[model samples]
Target: MENSQNQKQYWKENIRLLFILLSIWFLVSFGAGILWVEELNAIRLGGFKLGFWFAQQGSIYVFVILIFIYVKLMNKLDKKYGYDD
Candidate 1:
């Protein structure tokens, strides 16, 4: 019974992290890149437009950062739950 509870808790943590990461990804890729694009374009990033940068490169960068973040977070969570090797 305790083992089952532990498993459930671990799964819950995983799902929660997944949700949080995906939300950020969506916000960056869709929200900044498309939804607020016109407003963002008004600002310049170096020589590039903010909206164009986000749509072309920023989202990809954010996704890479999110991957690292997920790995780091899951490692911490694993250690906390005695799941780490």
Candidate 2:
């Protein structure tokens, strides 16, 4: 029973983490790509329009930063939950 419960908890945590990461990914991609493009387009960075910047470069940078942040945060979360391997 204890082992089964632990397994379930592990799966739950994994699923939760996946969902959070996916949501962030979608926000950076689709959200910025479509939903927020107009607002972002008003701002400029160097020669690029903001929406174009995000659609082209900004999202990639944000994705990389997010990956590192996720790794660091997940490490902390793993340690907290005694799930670090």
Candidate 3:
């Protein structure tokens, strides 16, 4: 019973983290890439429009960084829950 409860808590934390991470990903990819594009386009990045940069390259870069951040966060959470592997 205790073990089951621990498992539930671990999963809940894991899912919460996942949602937070994905939300950031969406905001960067969709919100920055499309929604606020025009406003972003007013800014320039190395001769390229900021909006275009995010749509083409910035979002992907952020996503890749997010992957490593997710891994690091999960590892810490796992250790905290005594579920390290």
How does each model score on TM-score? 0.90, 0.73, 0.91
Error of 1 at 51 (Å): 0.8
Candidate ordering by lDDT (highest first): 3, 1, 2
**lDDT of prediction 2:** 0.83
lDDT of 3: 0.95
- Assess the local accuracy of residue 71 in candidate 2 as a C-alpha lDDT between 0 and 100: 92
lDDT of each: 0.95, 0.83, 0.95
Write one digit per residue (lDDT tens) for candidate 3, span 22-76.
9999988999899998999999999889998999999999999999999999999
Better of 1 and 3 by TM-score: 3
How many clashing residue pairs, candidate 2? Answer: 0
Separately for all candidates shown, the number of backbone clashes (residues 3 or more apart, or on different chains) is: 0, 0, 0
RMSD of 3: 1.1
Candidate 1 global TM-score = 0.90
Candidate 2: stretches off by over 4 Å: none
Report the lDDT tens digits of candidate 2 across residue range 1-85. Answer: 9868877886788789879887988888888866899898998888988888888888898899888978987887777667788
Pairwise lDDT winner, candidates 2 and 3: 3
Model 1: per-residue lDDT, tens digit, 9-83?
A: 998999999999999999999999999999999999999999989999999999999999999999999988889
State which candidate, 1 or 2, has the greater lDDT: 1
